[model samples]
Target chain A: MALDGRIEQAVVAALALSKGADAPPRLQAALDHAVFPGGARIRPTILLSVATACGDDRPGLADASAAALELIHCASLVHDDLPCFDDADTRRGKASVHRAFGEPLAVLAGDSLIVLAFEVLAQAAGDHPRRAVDLMRILAQRTGMPGGICAGQGWESEAVIDLAAYHRAKTGALFIAATQMGAVAAGQDAEPWEELGARIGSAFQVADDLKDALLTPEEMGKPAGQDAAHQRPSAVAEMGVAGAVSHLKDILGGAIASIPSCPGEAKLAAMVRAYAEKMTPVHLSPVRG
Target chain B: MALDGRIEQAVVAALALSKGADAPPRLQAALDHAVFPGGARIRPTILLSVATACGDDRPGLADASAAALELIHCASLVHDDLPCFDDADTRRGKASVHRAFGEPLAVLAGDSLIVLAFEVLAQAAGDHPRRAVDLMRILAQRTGMPGGICAGQGWESEAVIDLAAYHRAKTGALFIAATQMGAVAAGQDAEPWEELGARIGSAFQVADDLKDALLTPEEMGKPAGQDAAHQRPSAVAEMGVAGAVSHLKDILGGAIASIPSCPGEAKLAAMVRAYAEKMTPVHLSPVRG
Candidate 1:
């Protein structure tokens, strides 16, 4: 199956488990809204790609890991868009979960998705117990405190924010989880994939900062310039748009170079290059000018 | 160690894992405040006791299960007290998490705790991978949709609520997790223990409804009469106070009768009896009249 179809199937199956007759309709609807019409799904794609590069020994576990990472990412988006935080009115060209479902159901939906992620991993443990545990650990480490998305969100409230650490936790953690979890799911050592994940993740953040600074809401399909509105630390703010773009290019080069020796290394490098080109600031390109 | 001490240690250790130097101070404070000075520690206590009754074979996994159950319960209370929900001012005689940490931190703290629960379980997966997976499944099943606490909370928003299903999902689910997880952690069948958990959980809800309708905030250490305030379905509302009290007694009787045959069955029976006595409405006694 195609990566998007596999991920969508996994997510749909997981959500269906919760849709008993007595299940709360609003919460269910909010969950579907938050998941469907997903963004680029870059994180899970990287995960599945890495798993394929590592030989894709356990297909079920790999699909579950990819689905779990996306679910956590989706949950974070829902929570981040809450009135108490960025208060985003729209996401992916539609109303944010809170805007559509009300804040209470949004909170519950985010929470339900988080639990659903773990439940998916646990259910996939039927034959590959060790791999399942590794997947769970990676997902939890990236989703929670100390160096997860939770820590990333926590950084916003701090008097002092370490720009690198903040970006890594907030955006890079899940990306890193994608790479490492993919390798582990394929029965390979996850360490070799760490640097690749970090570089790609950092590049992705820099690219996002550029978009947040330069794109209009119409262009981005979400609120724009949120970095400035929230007074949040951003690569564009610290380095200027041109400098941030240059940094993104440097990180993408490093990410391509960091791909480890594997049977599918060439294919993986090609995928990273593709993402690099896609995320490049087209308007800033001299050729475009 | 005593059950309370074991549970306390597990929770403290889990929170400590998140207290990196970079962790947000306010979020950390809120997480601590939500957990410390916990009210009764009822859920973990039941979990540990059930594990003991099942032979306490895997002590580490059992302790982790107990702690995970309690952490999830704490997280729910924090979210329940949010402004969009109860907007309560106090919990366990202290300011609620949102009241103390502000709504943003409260949401983050709750999210952090939920992830922490799974992290604790994942960390315990080393020697007993299957058991760990089982524990995770039971916890997620009770914490998420269909019949989880999330479903319970969702029931409140529905136009029609099935009181039994609502109570079971909202309150009974965790209790079921406590029993089932304990058994699974001990390498025993979790199914046999389900009825015991369900009956006890249902009984506890009735007792709580009675307290909410009859007691003062000072007595409950939180806002009272919230069911009526929110127009939520409650035993006291469905059946009058006297009828609710009688129902509680009957449920407790069934709970005691539901204890499955095990080596520690006698001790488990004694524990249930003590809880039943403690939760019995004092004013309903003839001696009090």
Candidate 2:
């Protein structure tokens, strides 16, 4: 199967475990609502791409890891949209999980997804126990505190913020997990894959900053100019749109070059380049010029 | 070391990972506040006790498993107390995580603890990969959907509640995890331990219902009459005071009889008996009689 197909199948299979007949219908429905019609699916795609590049000897583990990473991302969005957080009314062109399912079910759904992510990994661990354990570690570290998305969010509540740490954790953490977990899933050293993910993550963050600064809410699907509205530090805010665009190109270019020497390094490079093109299309190329 | 000491040490060590210097200070404080001076530490204590009864060969894995179970329990309490859920002002006799650190941090702290629970198990998985995988599976199944604590909470949002499923998923889920995970950590079959956990969990639920109905908020150290206020179904609502007490006795007695044949069967039975005594003390006997 292609990456998207495989990703969808993995997600479906994993969610089936949570959608048993006995499950409370609303919570189960909330899980579906949070996940399906996913936005971009960039993280899981990156995970599978890396896994494939590294041989993907254990396809089941790789697929589960990819799905697990994406589930964490989705779970974060659910919590992020709660009334206490961003209070986002819509996401991915639809009502946010909390908006659609009510706050209590949304919270349970997010919590359920987090647990289900590990369950997915654990279920696939039977044949390749070590790889599964590694995936869980990476997922946990990237999803939780100190240097994870949760920590990234936690930084916002602090009086003093570390901009670099904030961006690295808020977005870079999962991308790093994507690359490292993908490599580990395919029996490769996770350390060698970190730089590639970090560069890609930086590129994506810059692109997001540019889009938020330049695009309207209609163009972005969800609310736009949220960075300025919330007074959040952003690449565009720190270094003008033109500068952010230039920096994005630099990061994406570095991402392609950072691919560790693997059996399919060329293929992975091409994939990253393709993503870069999508993130920074021809229309915006002349904006910096 | 004693069960309490081991449980505390394991929790501290596991949390230390998330409490690194780089962590957001308030978030770190929230994590500590959510866990410290814990109520009875009963879940972890039960886990350690079961592990002991089954010959805790892998002491590290058992300790980590015990802590992980308790963290899940604590994480549930944090979310359950959220304004979106219980809208509670206090938990464990202190301002709830949300009340103390605000809603966003409370959400993150709960999330961080959940990830940390899986990380705890993963960190200790190196030596006993199979056992660790088993532990993870059990934890996930008991903590997430259809049969977990999250599912238990999900039931509350439904129009028609299945009381058995609600009770099973709610209080019974973690108790089951404690017993089954304890057995798995000790390299025993988890299936055999389910009955003991279910009965014990049932007993605890009945005891809780009785306390909520009979005790003052001052005695309970938190709000009372919540079940009546919310109009939620409970053993007390169904069976009244005397009937609920009799039912509690039946369940606890059955729990003792349900202990799976193990090396430390006698000791395990004694521990359950001690817990039952504490749960149903002398003062309450006359009210039911």
Candidate 3:
């Protein structure tokens, strides 16, 4: 199966585990809505690609880790769009979870998905107990406080912000989880993958900054220029649009170069290059200028 | 050290793990505020007591599990008090996290704590990998969907409710985790302890129903009659105050009887009897009448 297909299947199966006869239909529907028709599926793709690069010895564990990462990403998006936060109306060209299904269910759905991520990892532990523990640690570290996505969100409330730390926790953490967890799932050392993950995560954040700065809501499929409106520290805000774009290029280059020495190093590098091309803004073409 | 003291230390240390120079001060404060001065500390107490009854072989893992359970409980309370949910202004006789730090911080705090729970377990895995996996599974099952606390919260949104399933998910799930995780942490078979946990959990819920229906907000240190106001399914609503009180007694009796044959079985029974006495409403006293 294709990477996206596997990820989708794993996600569906994970969510299905929660579907009881007595479960609130609305919460289940909201969860389905949050997951299906995902954004880029970039995190899971990176995860699986890395796992495959490292032999992909445990396909089931890899898929579960990838799905869990994606679920956490989706859940963060749902919560971020809540009225208290970004209050975003549209996500992936549709109404945000809260807009579509009241705030309470949105909160519940997000919470459920977070728990589901751990549950998926735990259930997959039957085959590889140690790897399961490692996956859980990687996911949890990247999702929680200090240097995780939660800290990334918490940084917004602070008076001063460190752009690198903020971006890392907000965006880089999950990417790190992807690469590290992918490696771990494939029975490889996780440390070697961290640099590559960090680079990709940094590049992704810069690309996001660029899109937020330059795109319209219709073009982005979500609210644009939100960073400025929210007074959130952004790469574009810290380094001007052109500078941010240059930084993105530099980071992607570093990402491609940072691929660890693995059985599938060449393929991993190619994957990074492909992501770099995809993330590069089309309007930045010299001919357009 | 005593169980409560150990739990307090573990909780303090767990929250401390999230504290960094860059962490949002408000978020750190809110996380601390949510956990400290905790109400009852009943879950962890039960967990530790069960672990003790089962030999307390791995004290660190047991403490971590106990702390993780309490953190999950604390996170649930923070989310439950959100404006979109209960919108309660007070918890444990003080302002709720959302009320004190705003909704965004409250949400972030809750998310961070949830991740912290698993992170604590993962960190403790070095000493006992298999037990850590078991702890993660137990915690996830009790906290997430299908049968976890998330499912418990989701029950509120349903058109029709199954009181048994709802109470089990909402209340019984954590108690089950407490017993099962305790046993797992102590290297004992967790299944034997499930009945005891279930009975204790059911008893606690019934007692809560009685308190909510019969007590005032001041007396409860939090909003009373919330279940009735929210139209949530409650034992008192289903069985009435007197019947619920009777049910509480029955559950307590079953809890005492359900003690597994552990070395500390007598001590565990004594603990249950003490809780039963504590849960019995004061007004029910013949002298008071």
Candidate 4:
């Protein structure tokens, strides 16, 4: 499927899975509101691409993996916007979940999304129990641990931290899970794909940092530069903005190079190049303007 | 195996599994601290009893199941104590995790425990993939729903709330999961044990409410009366203290009645009755000269 088609399919499926039975009407509405008008499905797209490259015969399983990872990403965003975290009033050019619903519901909503990610994986990993279990492990590690996204958030409170560890766990972990899960779904037993995922995942995090430091909220469709407010470390913190950009290109190159051993490496490389070009500092200006 | 002996063995094993290869020193230390000096292993005790009553031949499986539920409960307590939530300074008469380890590491510690709960279950249910999967579903629902404990906290912000649904989802869900997991681990079919679990689960929630409202922090080893501070509804809210006491008896009776259909029903009932009595208002009073 085309990247946009994959993104659309994943988003719809993810939103559908989060609805609760006899749940507070506001919780369901808030989940839909946070998911709609859509945030970028960059992670899921990468997942789908990697799965396809790995010879996945089951498109539905691939879609489910993609959707599951995206739900986790979406959940982190909801929590990241809470008053105690980024304290942002808006997301995607609209009211943040906490602002739209109350803080209490928003917290629960974010948490529910996190749980729903696992639920989606459990229900969706049909005939791939082992892969599903592996996916759960990878996702859980990213969502919870030292270098995981939760740890990434926790790092904000520290006076000092390893910048590389922060970005890798906070942002890169989910991306890695996405790529790994996609490959696992495709029944590929290859090792190179994991390294490819880590490299690409890091590249994506660097790209996100570049956008946060350089792009407008309008361009990103989410608050920008809020990382500085919490005194959290970013690539832009360690490296100058221009230096971060160069580093991002290098990361992308490494990610692409790691993929050649897999089948259809060129197509995956092309996808990386196109996405990188579209998301770089130069491209962000027109969207902001 | 005796219930107390089973609990001791399970606690040791569960804590041992907390280690990770790439775990940060601070995160690891925080985890150790959070789980050690364990509380009354009440939920697990109840779970093991229920499992034994249900014809579970292996006591080891019951221990594992109980440990998983306790880990979940402990993890939730850690998160709930964060500045974003209760902002408590103490738990079990010691420094709360965020107070001890700082906010970031504390958060990661809690997140780790939550993931660890599932990991424990997944590892234990190695041969019974279906039962293991079902355990994940049950815990996931209890920990992350409209009526889940997390959602129960969210209900504090609503203008009106459903006491029964909130209590059932929050406290009752884990208890239910514990019973069901124990039974499943012991090879009981889903249908009968689920009903037995529901009864015991309701009683557990009522016991928790009794402790929360009527007991002092020194007596309970956690902060008391925070429920009123948050304006959240409780069994105390829907029914008077006397009514809550009566409700506990009724729920316990139902739980015991459901047990006669299973093996070792009398012993299980006796243990449950003893536990419920120990948790009663008079039993929880602060000591006096």
Candidate 5:
């Protein structure tokens, strides 16, 4: 199966237990609502691509890793859109989890998903114990504080922010998780995959800033100009749109170049190049220009 | 060392990564605030006790399981005190996470702690890979949906609530985890330990309801009559304070009787008896009466 199909299947399996007859219907529905109709599925896709590049000897573990990374990503989005944070009303072109389900269920949904992500990895640990352990550790590291996305969010509350560290953690952590976990899932060294993931994450953040600064709410399907409204630090706010766009191109180039010595290095580069195109808008596409 | 000391040491180690200089200062503070000055440390104590009863060959894994369970409990309390949920201003005799650090930081702190729980388990995997995986899976199951605490919270939102399931999930889930995970940490079967945990959890919930209904805010160190205020399901409300206290006695009796045969059965029973005495109020003490 393709990466997309594998991701969906794995996510379905991970959520099956929660959707049972005895489960609370609304929370189960909220779980479904948060995950389904996913946008891009980029993190899991990168995870699988990296795993494939590293031989993917344990396909089951790789699929679980992919699903786990995406679940964490989804979980973050749910929490990010809560009233205390962005108060975003829309996500993936639909009502945000909090908007659709109310604040309590939204909070519970995000928490459940985070727990479920780790649970999925542990469930898949039957035969691939070491790899599963590695996947959980890496995912937890990227999901939590000090160096994870939670730390990234925490940076926002700081009186003075270090833009670089903030972006590295808030934006780059999970992308790094995707690559590192992917490599670990396939029995490879996780360290070598970090650069590629970081670069991809940095490029995406820049691209996101460009979209928020340049696009309308209709175009983005959620609130736009949020960074400006919230007085958040942004690449586009610091660097002009043109400069941010250029920076994105540079980062994507580095990402492709940093594929490490994998069996399918060329294939992974091609995949990154494809994503680079998708990430760069057509009007200012580096490839088009 | 005793279970209490082991639990504290393990929790300290788990939070070390998040307490570094680089972490968001407020978030680090919030993490410490939430976990420190713990209420009873009852859950972890229960977990370690069960592990010891099962012949704990791996103290490290037992410690991790204990800490992980406590972290999950702390995370839940942090969220429960959020404005959207219980809107609780205090917990554990002090300002709740939200009150102390504000809403955003509280949310992030809770998320960070939840991730930290799984990470603690994975980090302890080492040579105890199987036990580690079991621990993570069990912890996640109790933390998340269907039968977990999240499911317990979700039952509140439903129009038609299953009272038994609600109590089983919200209060009983982690208690079950404490016993099941304790057994798993000691390389024992988890199923047989469920009844004891369930009875203990049920007793705690009743005792909590009794406190909420009877005690003043000064006595409880937090809000009182909350269950009645929120119109939440309460054993005291349903069964009356007298009947609820009696039910507490019955559950404690069952809890002690339900202990599975183990190397330290007598010791475990004694510990349960101690908790039973603690759980029952002076006016309602079954032993005194």
Candidate 6:
């Protein structure tokens, strides 16, 4: 199936899970806000891709992992937009949660998403408690402290930061989780898949940094130049725009090459290569102009 | 084993699971902030108590459940103190997360706790995948949208509010979750336990409102009148302190009476009675002065 099909299936599953005879209207609204006109759904796409590479018998698990990842992403976005963090007024070309529903609800919404992510994963992986536990650990690690996205957010408050650590967490962590989770869902070995994910995630983050340097706010939805404005270190800051572009290419190349020889390797490899190629020079070109 | 002993064991187990090999310094600090001098580990206690009541040999599950519940509570507190929500400067008589660490680290720490809660629960209940799923679902519902704590936060934003709904969410939801989760951990049917927990949680919220109305800032360890200041509807506002006190007794009575006949019935029943009596007006006179 195409990435869009897989994402739609994941979104549908997520929406279906949110339903209950006792579900409150506010909760329904919050769930809707979480998934409607969703962001890239890149995590799920990667997860599905890896799962497909492994085998096709695990579509349900793939969808569940995708939904869980999106829930985490949505939670982070809700928290990130709070006044304490980015204070973003808009997301996905619309008012951010704090802006739309107010701060209190926004916080709650984020909290709910975090809880729901685990719920979805647990329910979806009922027979695979070990995998679920492992997946939960991976997701939690990426979401929180020291080497997680939350830590990445913390780096912004400091006087100085290690850019590599920041990139790895702020972007790479979830992507790493996606592939690892996907591989686990498919009953494949997790470590090699995690490495592939890390590379892809790192490349993706760099591409994002390049876009932030080169794109207009209209193109990217949120404000551009935030990295430079905040003096948040980035590949673009360290390597310059052209150098960053070249680096993204190298990272993407490595990511594509890392996909192991397997039964569905051709399709999976093609998807990775296509995604990276399209993400790198082509996306960067528009932003630079 | 005694409740305190169980708590210690659970904490040790949870801490051992922390990432970063030696347990990251920041996470260690957070664990202390979360566990030690912790506000009642009532949820986990109830879970163990319920499990004991159910004749389950697995007190380990309950202990882990308690630790996980505490983590969730800690996570919520960290988020609650952010610049956007209560914006409180202190928690548990000490500096709130944002005040102690920077806002960013505080956010990350909170997120970590939320993630850790799920991870612990997943591992703790590894032997019972169905129970783990149930626990996750129950936790998600209590913490997630509409009726969950998150939805409760969202309700604060609207121009109009339902006072009962607000109280149910802000305080009661987690309490309900705790009882239900404890019941599940004990491998018992959830209905009776849920009823007991709901009543207790409702009464607990009323008590919290009473605390807000009656306690001095020194006694409460936080600003006492902020709810009224924010014009947020509270039990004290709707019922008056004395009326709220009466309601607490009624709710506690209901909760105690709802406990199923079981091995631990006498002890659990006694504890509930004592807690309710202590909270009631007749018994509260001594503490009032």
lDDT of 3 by residue, A121-227 (tens): 98888757888999999999899887889999888887777766788788889999999999999999899999999998888777887888887887877678899
* Candidate that beats the other on DockQ, 1 or 4, i.e. the better one: 1
Higher-DockQ candidate of 4 and 6:
6
Q: Candidate 3, residues B1-289: lDDT per residue as tens digits?
A: 2777898988887887788886667788989999989888999999999999989988999989999999999999999999988998999999999999999999999999999999999888885787899899889889987888888888787788777788888899999999999889999988998999889989988888778877789988989888889777787788777777777889899889988898999999999999999998587432332
Docking class of 1: medium
lDDT tens string, model 5, A1-289? 2788888998888888566566789999999999998878989999999999999999999888888888899999999999999888988878999999999999999999999999899999978787789889999989897889999999988898877778889989999999999899999988988999999999989888888887778777767898899877788788777778888889999889888998999999999888888888685443432
Chain B TM-scores across candidates:
0.93, 0.97, 0.96, 0.85, 0.96, 0.89
Off by over 4 Å in 4: A1-11, A14-17, A226-242, A260-264, A281-289, B1-21, B54-64, B83-85, B102-107, B123-125, B208-244, B281-289
Candidate order, DockQ descending: 2, 5, 1, 3, 6, 4
Docking class of 2: high
TM-scores, one per candidate: 0.97, 0.98, 0.96, 0.87, 0.96, 0.90
lDDT by residue for model 4 (A142-232), tens? 6775556776666565556666666667777777777777787787753556677777777777777677777778877777886676566
User: In terms of DockQ, which candidate is stronger, 2 or 3?
Assistant: 2
Query: What value does the lDDT take at residue A75 in candidate 2?
Result: 96
Model 5 residue A76 CA deviation in Å: 0.8
Native contacts kept (model 2) = 0.81
DockQ of each model against the real complex?
Answer: 0.77, 0.85, 0.76, 0.38, 0.82, 0.45
Per-residue lDDT of B1-289 in model 5, one digit per residue for the tens? 3677778898888888566666788889999999998878999999999999999999899988998999999999999899998999889789999998999999998899999999899899889888899899889988898889999989888899988888899999999999999999999998999999988899899999888887789889999989989898898778787788888889899899999999999999999999888878595443332
User: In terms of DockQ, which candidate is strongest?
Assistant: 2
Stretches of candidate 6 off by over 4 Å are A19-31, A126-131, A283-289, B19-36, B215-218, B222-243, B281-289
For each model in turn, which proportion of the native inter-chain contacts is also found?
Answer: 0.70, 0.81, 0.73, 0.29, 0.81, 0.45
Best candidate, lDDT? 2
Report the number of clashing residue pairs per model. 0, 0, 0, 1, 0, 2
Query: What's the DockQ of model 5?
Result: 0.82
Q: How big is the positional error of residue B18 in model 5, measured in Å on the Cα after superposition?
A: 1.9
Model 2 / residue A123 / CA error / Å: 0.4
- Per-residue CA lDDT of model 2 for A176-267, tens digit only, reads 99999999999999998999989988998988887888777777776789899998788888988778888898898888888999989999
